[model samples]
Target chain A: MKKLFFYTTLALFFSACNKEEKQNYSNIAIYGHGGAGFESHTNRLPANSFKSIQKAIEVLNADGVEVDLQIDSNGTTWLFHDQFLEGKTSGNDCFGERSTSYIKTCNYNLGGKIFQLQELMDYFSSLSPKPKVSLQVELLDRCIDHSLLIEQLIAIMEVNNAYDWVQIESDSPGLLIQLKAASKHFQTFIRAPDLTSCINLCSENGFDGIIMNNTDVSVKDVERVQALGFKIALFGVASQAEIKSALKKHPNQIQCDNIELLHRIMKQ
Target chain B: MINKGTAFILSLFLFISCPTFGQDSLSSNIKITTHFGYEISNVGCYGNIGGQINYKKFGFGLAYILDYSDANGLDGPFGVATTLSFSPNHSDNKVINHFINLDYRITFHQRFCTFDCSQKYNKIQELNIGYGLSIKIFKRLSISNTINIGWYLEKSLSDRTGKTISESGSNSLINAKLNYLIAK
Candidate 1:
């Protein structure tokens, strides 16, 4: 009986050391969420910061990045996430309530400087090899003039020649409609709350795709959405298990918070 | 606020120094043990340190754990655990002792926030039940391994957006411990 126990333990130890099966993830695109994600404590760099974005693209070698863009009072787009800047920065008002001069002076309590959308576009245009990375920009609609915001965004895209590599996402159907009307070259996606709404919105409005939270959708839901001919992207993944589950759903893209984990898993 | 690790360590020493219950005078049946181990769970792995007091077939223990799984340095969640165990063959004098246990742990997860920002603490309470076997390896040292199924109850404070991220679920934990008999 003792020998049996010893041999059983030995066998289990060897089994644990066996190589894990490698999975093929060539079809899935990995995008860093708000640069590297919004972990309150785990993230080294603040989300939506230029440093985080640069690390996600240049160091992590992610497929692309999903950033939050808020239009200030001056109608210049800024990369920010919160509806109000009081908690994360020294500023007290919303981005739309502040001008370019005020926004530029306001510093993130996390140490990095707040950046303009133009800066990100300029960085992309300046890349010599033109890094093959797509940028999915989510519009944080506050108290801003939608028409002016759209016009300014279109001008930025045109000046940087970013229409082909940049995609826009928003929860507001009205904004998407205006964008599509303004430019046929723009690729728009609806940030849907559910599978049914996603399908209905994409099919009804002729949106290019849908973006949903990873936890809100299932494997079958992803398959069903893809079966309907609309691309799907899942976000809010933080751990290895969540990443693996998101990959299993086989969404066209994943806006991951843990870019390193996603990159390692994809390599495996 | 007192440091969580320091408070737990102080409490552990106080618990060890307290006299045993009941005055039956069979002092030999009472045993004090100190243990250090590694625990692996679905969420992450932790380094565990604690001590236990056993009387006949029943034992009680307290442990402090530090998480070491993620790349965020040692800023991962730290936990305090209390366990009650029953060993049916504790007095059999055999080389192996098999036990069943119920464990409750509370882990504090700090939210990401900037310096001087009002940081929120997310607390996760977990209840676990498991079986373990300890084998005597030396005069007063033994090695043990336990496998547990934990039901985690998570309560998260709101983020800057006033949205709470809920991660309530069940996971498994496996522990390997090296124990020393301090008193018998």
Candidate 2:
């Protein structure tokens, strides 16, 4: 009995140490969330910065990046995530309330220059193999004319020849409708609140895809969405477990916070 | 200002020089040990200081663990652990001592946000049961390795938006400890 117990414990130990079987993830596209992700502690650079975006594409070799875009007073699109610049940057007031010149002067508290969306597109245009980019348009300030903002953004993409590689995502259905109506070539996605809403919104609005939080949907829900002939993208993945869970669902894309961790797991 | 490494070294030296009390027998002697180890878990590596009282093959210990990771700056998930251990074979002459332990730990997870400059804290309680193998390297020093499967009883977090999210999951931890016996 003692010998049996010892062997059983040893067998358990070995089983625990063994690695799990690796699954093929070639079909899944991995995109960085706000560039290389937005962890306050782990991230070396500020989120949505040019440097962060560059690192995610160049260093991490991600399939693409999902960046937050907010238009300034002069209708120039800038990369930012916050509604108000008070906490994230040295400047006060809403990001949309500031002008191009005033916004340029405002630096991120984490030490980086505020860059324009045109600059990013210009850079992408210069690359030999342009990386895929997803612009998450934030319609926070109701004062800014949405039509003008959309026009400016569309123009920038057209001028830079970025339409082929760029995809647009937004929570506002009105903005998405306007964008889709403006150009059918543009791949527009709706950021849904939940799985049920995600499927309903995508089917109803005829969006190219639906983006939902990884935790909000199950594997069956992801399959259900895909079975309806709509692409599904999952985000809000930070840890290894979250990444694995998201990958198991086999979504079309994943906007991960820890791109390096996801890459490591993919390699395994 | 002593860093954690320096403080551990200082404590090691102090423990090494401390006088032994009572008999040197395994059953009668109480052992105070300081363990420095790396943990392979989401919570990251940890440094532990603990004391144990043994009676024959059975032992009980209380340890304070400080978990830290350099990959994500100074994110800390410190914990307090209580372990009940049983040695299958306990002999001073044996070079290898194998034991099984059941540990209950309460860890405080903390994350500091740069956006709002806010500190988010949460409590996670888990039970880990596993086996360990310790090799006696010196007269009063041993090197040990343990692998545990932990089941979280309760784990909840408040994200950057201050939304409370509860998750249920299980994780495994592998730890290697350089244990120094202060009293035996």
Best prediction by TM-score? 2
DockQ for all models, in order? 0.03, 0.04
**Model 2 spans with C-alpha error above 4 angstroms:** A1-16, B1-184
- Model 2 CAPRI quality: incorrect
Question: Over the stretch B1-184, how does candidate 1's per-residue lDDT look in tens digits?
Answer: 4334434444445444443334245487788788888887654577777888898899998888776654332335688888899998785368899999998888776553222235456677778899999999987899999999977766554322333444445667788999987677
Tell me candidate 1's interface RMSD: 15.0
Error of 1 at A83 (Å): 1.8
TM-score of each: 0.59, 0.60
State the local distance difference test value for candidate 1: 0.73
Q: Tens digit of lDDT per residue, candidate 2, span A1-268?
A: 5744554455455445435698899899889898878845435467899867865665556778899888878888888888788888899897777888999999988678887888888777766567788899867677566777889987887777676789899888888888777777778888867777767777787788998999999999989989999888898898878998999999999999877567656655
Give the deviation of candidate 1 from the true structure as CA RMSD: 14.0
Please give the distance, in angstroms, between residue A266's alpha carbon in candidate 1 and its true position after superposition.
3.1
Candidate 2 displacement at residue A72 in angstroms: 1.2
Query: Which residue pairs show backbone clashes in model 1?
Result: A40-B111, A40-B112, A41-B112
